[model samples]
Target chain A: MTSSAMQQLYQQIILDHAKSANGAVAELAALDADAATAASAAGVRLAQSHQVNTTCGDEITVRVGLSGTGADARIDEFAWRGAGCSISMASASVLNDTVRGTTVAESEAMLDLFREMLRSRGTIEPDEEVLGDAAAFAGVSKYPARVKCAMLPWVAFEAALLQLAEPA
Target chain B: MTFVAPPPAPARDPSDQTPSDHAQTDQPLTDRSGSDLTLSSDEVLRIRNDFPVLHQLVNGHPLAYLDSGATSQNPISVMEAEQEYYEQRNAAVHRGAHTLAFAATEVFEAARATVAAFVGAAENEIVWTSNATEGVNLVSYAFSNASLGLGGPAATRFRLGTGDEIVVTEMEHHSNLIPWQQLALRTGATLRFIPVRADGTLDMTAAGEILNPRTRLLAVTHASNVVGTINPIDDLVAMAHAVDALVFLDACQSAPHLALDLTALGVDFAVFSGHKMLGPTGIGVLYGKAELLAAMPPFLTGGSMITTVDMQGAEFLAPPQRFEAGTQRISQAIALASAVDYLSHTGMHRIRTREAELGRRLVEGVTAIPGVRLLGPGLGVERIGLAAVDVAGVHAHDVGQFLDEAGIAVRVGHHCAQPLHKKLGVTASTRASTYLYTTDDEVDRFLAVLAEVAPFFGVSR
Candidate 1:
């Protein structure tokens, strides 16, 4: 009864978020204690931080590193693991991989494009080659409420950027 | 006067009056018609024994009911009232000259009088509907019909068109909100709501802004079902009246706890449920001002509600009979009247006082327990007989489970006020409600069990 765009919002991205969150402590629990602590400590110095989806408790811990030689910082390591629905976990995993080599400015640009795509705010066509695996979530932008679940990680990434500016 | 019991002073507070106190229990209850006031603990306990559902094991424990806000346990007298009517006088009322039909009609009309006297509304102003939801919808539907000029002079009272606003509060139940929304959608009217303050009270400033000259009707709850906050309706009523806006009260929560005087309150319409007032379900009462009732169009039609029928069209009967269409909930209405009699026998003042005491105890006990955050104001005295709390770091569903295992029943989730809960910064909260039948021992047991379970659930100080 609803539009295909609406169907896309409830896509695998949100179902995955609810079913298998990719950055939760469950994944951390699988790692060696030393490695987990190392990752957490490494993240503490980064301007960006982790944020949890309160509605379903999915989380994403984002970290950004500036090369000092360039105007934009590189996403040095975008590793995440959590317990949630498959779509959320898969989306978080793919997001971490996709943003790793991308510059801070491009990431910001992509984040803008991603939000618009998810909301069906207007006509948005994601470049398949550039969007990579994140494009699998293109259909998910249709469900207004579910868009939050798909975009939770990206919002955390933005929050991380703000923190970078503040050095917290 | 044989076995002279005191005259039941329907509105008087008996605590300060000594002579009336003695007469309350002086007369033998054998005569059901006798208006008694002094119901002792033993007698009240015996009366409780008559309700079969009260004695039961829920979740492998003695069911300590703490959710009367959802619904009340009905007594035998009320239950039998329905059966008695069906057995003896089950025919359609306000029609037919047969003896059974006349008797049924008399009983039905008398039930209306009983409910009217209970809420201090005139008998002719009472309209029976399926439930409180229907009662509210009836008014909205009637207003929509009236705006279309259906009931002539009566229709003029409800005429709302473009620029007319329907005022409600954020704390309204969905039953109260959705109908007004649909009415607004149907009419070109605007639907506005008063926001809740930080402590769950109405944001009067927002209310003032919302209820201006454009406001045609104001519908709000007398109490919050989730937060347990008794709203300041007197000010709201006065404010609506200042702008000549008609006021309709959703008395679902208040009817069971506080004594209501609809006429004295000066509200145009008041709707409440029989089931919530310790009566049977499937019956609700709608009290409209006599003039307004005379003017409003009938919501439902067909059968006994007709005055004179012709080939072209039909003239409807007066006030209640006009509103009531098809076969009524005859037994349920009679039983609801009997429930009113029960409340009268207990004396509402005494019930109110006792529940306040119980509320205080419940709040104090819950507050003393670490990690329990009381949600509403006036810990015990500040609210009606309900209390809601957010147990720190624990999901409300978990808290509810822990309490259920302790033999204490509570309501969880957003309590059908999703937006209100979101505003209060919680997805859900646990609530325990009290009633006239609730005792001090039950409150103590609840506290003892909560303390024992909170620790087990890793809830720390």
Candidate 2:
């Protein structure tokens, strides 16, 4: 197939997300408190946010926080920014809602799960209990570049967890 | 996006007469096409056949070339000029005393004469460089060397130091921009730009403010690759001259498409790549005023460019030879001269006229398709033979992909003018450019293929 056939993938959902990618900023204080709470129960805190969708410039921010002993992470805030296709933003939005307040080890494990689920490389569905909002992005794995968009929030969540694990 | 193979270049039967033998076939010609747009089909075909690459296919598809802004297809005559040199009298020019060397040297110098004639400059003013990029870097690096106080008395003209300014346009390709930026950084000078207006024209009003007494040099593109806007160079040159600043022209986009006479333009230095002008890659021309080039120190030293050499030091060769230090792209240079001959034969004025007509047709056709917003000037006076457009709601990548599927090739993204792209309020754009080989049928087919873009992307009708 010629490079042009790749054009078929620019679905309407993508355009909508590109046209209106609001709600990028989030309340940092509230999300921070959630991180503190998650850390108390687990050894570390975790937060995730989507940065930018590389494909069409769509970006979402997901912040993960760990409250207690840095064992677990709690979803503090999920915000989106930029303009891009719908699948990426929708996927990030969904992923943010699903993985809040998970343990550090569990969050680490869930990263692979999320990646696999987003890619559809594995026959597993996202853990419904954990992947709540992120389920919309499960089909996004079909497009390789979009996977980065879907994974951005998750990566941010992991970063927040790592930050909590560091000695203050 | 899929990239179909570009058509295979037609095999040339070496028995054909060499280009030089037929160089005068279309001489005594001027800009007239000898027929109307639709009124002269034979004339158009004649012009088309002059470009050898157009006769081939890419991946079983006839090449629908729209990438002239990137590079143009060379004519057979250009190829023959390069090949015939090696086949007939191959020798190291100007370095050997034998007949072969003399003959080779004659052709080499004559090629320089041809180029000087083409650009409306004296033969002494034309300095051969690897390509336009090298030419820009040559000027930039020379300035840097001068700033270090190492170039002797000739260095005074380039002594840019603290509080000095080097002006460039925002529309410059990275090649023209970066070297100046680096030069400024090294010399404590300021790097400034003439801002682009909303209509894709240079903001001359802003340029007036930028070119003050502190300005030392001004570099600008003759034509924009992405938006296809020919710059207001007269105003820019005048502005820079007012401040005693030397002006450099990046003619990569304009030289092939327009009739350029560097002397008339009054720029201190002008640079263009051969590939973009229907010659082979790996060669370019840098034309500098004889006095200025003579004053500028050599950027590279050793080999062919040197004169009398002592154990402690060495004197350099004259102007052009001083700049071209190494063995040059001899064959490529020969081919480029031939390409110039081909353009001259077709009458650059006629080519430019035809392209202008096509630009008008392209603008009309592309605009008529709903949801396509053409960027830059809509008319010939402000625009050139290219069009950049945004298909409503569709990403540029997707647009390129769709076009590629239909055997149409166009450039996407910032086209290496990121600042201009940002100024235009677009992350990227889909650009369709044309040259001599572009035809009315190709334009019509392109428009037809583009009409399918919105529907294929499911963009709102």
Candidate 3:
């Protein structure tokens, strides 16, 4: 077997990010703690969303904290903890790195772009400047089944933001 | 990660297949299969060619179709039978008095007779349903009707009331589990289960305690889909019968791989899907003792099933037709009969012998890998041609992907038996299920690729 198609799904970059959430230790630590305990992270407004891919039993809980309010709000950081395949784990790490400290609007826009590129099935070219390490996932779009694994954390991030909007 | 990824490694020739490189097999996996390992590679290649789908390449590698436990591929003969039916006789069975209808009905009933003979049952004893799930629901609802006094004094023997009990095993697929659960819930009968041991085999000692005289029915699988354990059905049947409890054998997994004679098994009723064997989907069989079926109320009631009808009420027909209330799965049933003929011609004992060899190779090959943990019986134990394994630190989906990239199609996840997964202490597993067509080269390659998975992901023992 030529490992080209397989390698597309398991790029070295994905393997690197998947093995190490080194850049996102704070976020990982926050996700590991109880919500109430993690809530004590200064003045940041934190919200959490947990998602599971029922078919393969992959689970992820993403926590996004916003510092500013409404239209001007900024995503302070992101953290997550769960168990899944490398695509899912790497996607979570890459998403955490790409979206941290960006404006809430910008993060959501990036999420939309990543989602759109993945749904494009490699038709819409991924912009490296915009997607950063996430452009590697453009190849993931080829596999319709694995697309969900890549999107699991991004969906959780969106859910976390919407969860923050609720009348708590 | 804060650090940047290094350049991608040049693509390695995945075809440079390494033998089971690990010495874990020295622990008796490879050496133990003395005679079972004698399935000639030449014979397997011939069988593989019979399946057109098996000859194709998936992702640039030869396809090793190992998910037969999910659904077996149709052979050319089964396909021809279905196409012939559509080409020549496509009319509804038992409906119009036209020549086409007459021909279709005769052929359809002949198909019934073929399947009936296949399972050592009388032709009148087989009832058609959409699939095995529907088969379970049909009997459960028949009991529901009986409990409501729908079939009058005859169904009294089948009815359940307060304090009555329904029993199943912890290992049943949802098809068998849910219908009985709903039946118990509706009729106020208590639902109970016989649990499995830590090794995934049924605890027959516990089964003894759970199945008491109040047990009105005992539903169980002939073999477990998840663990591949060929259950001890005869002893269980005797236990259930000693107390006058009716038995429903789930033959979905066993029907295709094993030589099954449901009548000899002595279960009061049984269910198996046609698609799981070498046939088309949309057809399944429900076998019952003729007397039981005659006494029970029909689960579905409509045109073809009725003897006579009025505004007030209707008299249902007898046995098989009484249960088949809609337009029948005519072509599918006929194709299934052809599949049965194919299996019979090839010889079930021969198939069973071949599968036993493949089954051991699967168990041995899988268990010999370091981090890959085989789910069911270990080496030297009897199981069907399947093996489900849990890869430590690597999710089942990843194992599936790694195997998929190598052109090995397998089943991954909870496998619709979450309760059994819970008992096995894993959230999900990767299952490679073989059939009459699987070869040793495919089994060996699967093991080799599986060994690569943990190392590829930087997970080490």
Candidate 4:
């Protein structure tokens, strides 16, 4: 029998999400081109950030698309491409699914809550309504070495969002 | 080569034993008909008791330490050596006129002699550095200084310019590769590497073609930290010498396992870390031929390494002292000498034979499992007692986690040889390395745990 720790870390939902990440990555590539075309036609802005975990050489490039202006803006699209352990890939998949149609403020709020939970070291109980499928990652917070794996995608997401805030 | 099980007795005759005798044995110790020192299973079990760290449980299982390539566990004697130095005779070496200072200086210099003899080099030829990385950097910086005409007339041979070239191998750890890369960048010289073959060995054809007249220096690993394949140093050294180029060996992996004779190898320079050889950290050895070191400039400057200091300039000491500036890792050095003594007493020949047997067992067992790809030379090919493998459908980190839960500690990453991994078409791999203290049961446990990894991850054959 698999230990509870192993089962908790590699939950069935996380494995399912990771297996579907390839199709999501392909969709992200298609959206990259669409965002580039849409940016010129409308006032839409797109930005991408690439991050690498030096310890294991896992890498991710997160692309974020913003529509409308300032605080009223919403995340029109969210996508990523990378290869890593299940935690990192599943987190990227979850980020794409949860934040796509939400306002930029709502996405940022979710990101803040997610970061807090990861840093909680298994102390903070995750809110299922708030995190959606990402709540499955609460077990990852217990492993200090693997916390970075769960956070790599989110870190890349924040960098992409920062790029969207620039004047150009 | 036949399977020659060495005699049950310890290898060396106790009367003829000397520190340098371990590395100077010319006969291939594996000859089936001859008497060779090989540790029996019971002897290895006895040796395990020397290392206190090995007697522990992790995750409710007996700890199987197979990560000696990363850093070895210290024996009680090695730890006590350091502690004894601090307790009884702790003083700054090569300075002061007090009794403790004299005693400390004697102990420090004695350690140097012991380490030098272990590697078959003269006492004056070994220079102390913080670690192997720093040792490589020391030589690289000296070359940089020489390139700028810092060491004066004798250093001209070390100089490099636009037309000059530096050659390394794809299998080098970043410590060896990056320093040469930066050196080439700084001096406007071209940097090149000998490609790795499909079977994870060096392409000697490429090496011969690339090491031309313009090649000023050839830096390569004595044994690959990732692949565990020992290079043909004699052939490579001869090739480099034919073109009048200098050779530097990264001996971090080889020195601990092999009977290293730097003098016999005829390399211009070599470096090894203390921690990897059952010694303490914060101390490493850089072995340079006397003539080469005398010609090279100093890398660091401060107290205890100078002759005279004027307001305008400071005259420096020669060779080892010149490179070793400031206060040294005195206690660590004393402890490393103890480590050398420990290995010497156990006999390197016996250690090598036993490890070779374990290596064969590990390679055969790991390769037998479906979906597992061994990274280094194939079965029956000679390699250091280590194996790095990639699972078909699993990431290295996941495999590592699975093994850790079974109380088996192994290194899982690029093993600091990223270019080699990139060439092999893998992001990372799992490596299990053994030392003198590693036992048969440990190797068996590692193999058993590894077999379970794929099935646990639901990977198909």
Candidate 5:
């Protein structure tokens, strides 16, 4: 007796992504967590951002590294480790796959679109051309509480990038 | 309904009354909480009808609100009481010269007297704060003021310093815990807590060691907002009093569900929020013993609380007024009195009896569901009508969303008790708390839905 909205919100695609995210935890743990603070002589650096949804106690930490500087900068390493609901974890997993090879500017644009889609309140159909698997979260916008759960990872991604942009 | 003010309760014990007497001689300190007068299923349905919001549908199914622990839904009478006041008797009280003003002040005092009588305190002993959080902060800051040499010689007992200790329990909501922690930080006193066992009951053996001579204040919840463990307040009050320490009960969870005779409870100070008890949001009550409130300095000082004013200084009014220092929550207070009337007319002991049955049902049902772990004391132990549980492999947020889709509204999170959740080895939990209006069928629906939770998440349990 699940409603259409609930099915749309927790689709098979999202559940699959969440299962993969749990599997990726061991791989994510192997990354140099300390690299977030220590930058080498290379112009690019690894940055990490830890975010929590205080309302529900969901927590996620995103770690990302860049391959170069300026316009040519490409996302080299993207990994996350956290404990939360399916929506948040699936979102992190989807974002990790979608943004890993894209340039930094493209990732930022994708994040902005994802955020706007979540705030659309079920009016704006998610542009899957940009969001990829992240588009599965379009139904989440109808629920103001769950929208935060969906956006948690992308916000962390932006924060990690912002940290990398800062003069190290 | 026209409200009548009850006579003020006399504080019978002397200021130096012995701790053992407060604990032992008052009555048998055993479990007097279990009342045999249970509400019938049809009577509960009638009670449910009184709450207009309970008859609604959400997500194409009937709404079953199990989040009364967060905020109880108001009955029709409580809502109408606030509306009637605004429509007919709206005026600024305690300062106006008009006829409406006089009327408003009279009704406002009547509300105070009603709430005071409900909690077994003198009318002058209750001070209105915005919420229970503000009430705790008010006392903490008043202690800070006293430590800084305010309230003159009468306030000397309120001071805390390097050697003083402020004790609290491990299960307190952050509203109760953080204020004391900050007060300790401000006054350089040591902050200690009596730990909770795996069963969610307070470790009384450890409690014996924690409450000692240096303990200046012992703040604990009358009942846990999370796990629904009703603390042994009589024994705790006795132990704290034995050390000559002040006791403050956070009755936010208890006052709404229990028959609270705060005088008989023997705590020095206590607080409960009005909204959780079916009143409006902007009003809360802080109950203190008459002498302690008389000696304490004001927390918020302004016009309504003053007696005389000069350019340099002003003399403060007594007790409640000294603490109430603004235009105040007038209609909210009236609405709260109406809520008190509703509860009193309904009978607090009957409500208690009904909730105990509901609590047992919740515990039994959830515990029977494989992979669901109940937080508080189990079957054969007494608790209020609530249960918080951790479902194996499914996150609480997901559980909440699933329940929402089923039109079963519940509270999901650490429930403002992160430390206790941490001690229980979880970041969040799903809590289903009931009130008098909650039906037996609704409890069954919750259990049925909860059984589907782990399986829906594809977890094998």
Candidate 6:
């Protein structure tokens, strides 16, 4: 008999996302190269951060592109490529989809909300209306070891954002 | 607490006793023949009672531990030995005129002698280090010291420059590989490795081509921690010696399961961790040839290791003392000696035979499951009672989680051998390893849990 904890941790949605992955491997590689080039060009700001969970060798390179300036600054794209467990991969896929078109401030707010939920240890009920597809990861909070897996992509996203905010 | 003596031996005709029971008599345990080594199923069940940690419930089911490759659980006797040392003879060894110090030094030196005998080395040949990582680093740093012209004429043989090469195997854990890599980088020497074959064994053809006269040293693992493939060390040692290159063996995985004899193996240096051998952590053994250790420069300096100092230059002691700096893990060393005693009493041949049977069962059982790929030597090959496997579509971490939910514990990921995993065409793998205390039921539970992993993740065909 499977415990409710195990069922919650490996939800059907997380499994489905991990299987499909959504982004093509070749396309992700191409986007990585394109992001690197754009980050070096004038007037187009891009930030890329590679995060690794040394414990299990789970890794991700997240690239966030920003267009426009100041309050009007918008997240043009969020792209990532890596290999990990279902929770980590699903969390990355959901993070890319949720933060693609939001403004800089809105993306920061989402990151903060996700971090808070993960730190709750299953106590904070996930707000699906706010987290969208990412809300399925609430079960991950119950496991301390899996928390790093769910946060790998988001931590990379935050690092990229911080790089974008730094003055040249 | 009242102490209870073991029941008296039953009176019977000497010829009627089985060889397994005879092993417990006055004869040397190592003298038992190969046919006498195999344990009955009932013996394995009885052996499990010695390890208290094995009796527990994890999650909601009986705990099945299959991660002994990482660290084996200690039996009660080993723990008691350490606690007794702390309670009675706790004092700084090799210092002072007090009775406690003399007693402590006696116990410490006794441990060194026991560990030396365990691996077939002289007491002076064994050097204490914090762990296996430090043991490897000690030798690597000696090479660096020789490169800087630290030890006199005797150390010149170890010196390397731009053209020299250090050869290692792809199967080495990072502990063995990274030190050589850094040494190469620091000394302008090239770092090379013998490629691993598809079966996870070393490629001797590549080894022949790589181990030329320019090769200053060759380091390899006796058995791989990831794939569980025991390398052909005799041939490799011969190849290294033919080129006048020194050889070092990483015995971390093999020391716990195999009967080790460093002198017989003909390696210049070897290292193994205590924690992995059912002993306490923070203590490890490094065995070097007597002459080589006497000539090599020290890695760490200060305290008891030195002979005299006047702020200009200092003379260091010989061999073991020169290498061991600062206060050592005295209690851990005692515990490790007790662990060695336990293993010796059980007879290494018997333990090895039992583990081989368990390993065969694990390999056969896990491979029988659908969508499972075994990474090491095939079913019939002789290995060190361990298996690393990759599922068809499920990541290793996911498989590990699924197994954990079923109360099975295993090591998942590259297992500190990322290069070997890449060579095997896998990002990671789940490994199930066995020690003497492991039972057939635990091995079966591990396989049963693994059978559910693919289906649980909806990846089954």
**Per-residue CA lDDT of candidate 6, range B1-461, in tens?**
33232222212244653333432355553444324666666655555665778889988788888999999998766776788778878899999887788878888888899899999999999999989999999999999998999999999988999999999999899999999999999999999999999989889999999999999999999999987877889999999999999999999998899898989999999999999998989999999999999999998988989998888999999989999989989999988998887787777778888888988998899789989999978777888878999999899998888888888899999999999999999989999999987878889989887888888889875
Residue pairs with backbone atoms closer than 3 Å in model 6 (clashes): none
**Residue pairs in steric clash, candidate 5?**
none
lDDT of 1 by residue, B1-461 (tens): 12222222222244653222322353445344232443345544556565667678865667888889888998765666677666656887766877777777777778788889988988988999999999999999999899888998747869989998999888888888999999999999999989997788899988888889889999999888987777888999999999999999999998888788888888899899999998998999998998888888988888878889999999988888889889988889888887888787666766666667677887888889888877766563367777788777555654565666556787776677766877778767878887876766777877776665445434466
Per-residue alpha-carbon lDDT of model 3 for A24-77, expressed as tens digits? 343344344565455555667788888999878888888788887777688886
Global lDDT scores for all candidate models: 0.73, 0.73, 0.85, 0.85, 0.87, 0.86
Cα lDDT tens digits, model 3, B1-461, are: 13232111111232434222111122322233343333355555655655778888987789989899999998766776888778877899988977788878877998999999999999999999999999999999999999998999999978998999999999989899999999999999999999998888999999999999999999999999999989999999999999999999999998887778988999999999999999999999999999999999988888799988999999989989999998899999998998887676556776777778778888888777888888978877788888899998788898899899999999999898989998999988999998877888888888888888887777875
RMSD of each: 14.6, 7.2, 11.4, 6.9, 7.9, 4.8
lDDT, candidate 2, B1-461, per-residue tens: 33232111222443665332223343433334455322244565666666666766754567788878877887776776778777865788779877777777777787788888988999989888888999999999899888888679877999889999999998889888999999999999999898888888888889999899999999999998877878878888888898899999999988898889999999999999999988889999999999999888878888898889989999888888989887877878878888887777666777777788778888999889899988776765556688989888776766765676566788876677778878888877888898876878888777888888777656677
How far residue A95's Cα lies from its native spot in candidate 2, in Å, is: 7.7
Q: Kindly indicate the candidate among 1 and 5 with the higher TM-score.
A: 5
Instruction: Name the docking class for model 3.
Output: medium
2 against 5, candidate with superior TM-score: 5
- Cα displacement (angstroms), candidate 6, residue B398, comes to 0.9
Evaluated on CA atoms against the true complex, candidate 1 attains a DockQ of 0.02
Candidate 4 Cα errors over 4 Å, as ranges: A26-38, A166-168, B1-36
Q: Write the per-residue lDDT of candidate 4 for residues B1-461, one digit (tens) a residue.
A: 23232221123444653322322234342343234578776556656776878888988889999999999989776886788778767999988987788778888898899999999999989999999999899998888999998989989988988999999999999999999999999899999999999888999999999999999999999998877888999999999999999999999999899899999999999999999999999999999999999888898989989999999989999878998899999999988998998787667878778778888988998889899999988776778889999988788988888788778899998988899999999999999999887888888888887887777767775
TM-score attained by chain A of model 2: 0.55
Best by DockQ: 5
Worst 10 residues of 6 chain B by lDDT: B3-12
Angstrom error of the Cα, residue B148, model 6: value is 0.7
Model 4 pairs whose backbones collide: none
The digit string of per-residue lDDT tens for model 4 on A1-168 reads: 356677887788887777787325553453366667878477667888888999988888888878887778888867789878777888888888888888888888999999999999999899998798989989888887888988999899899888777465
lDDT of residue B72 for candidate 4: 97
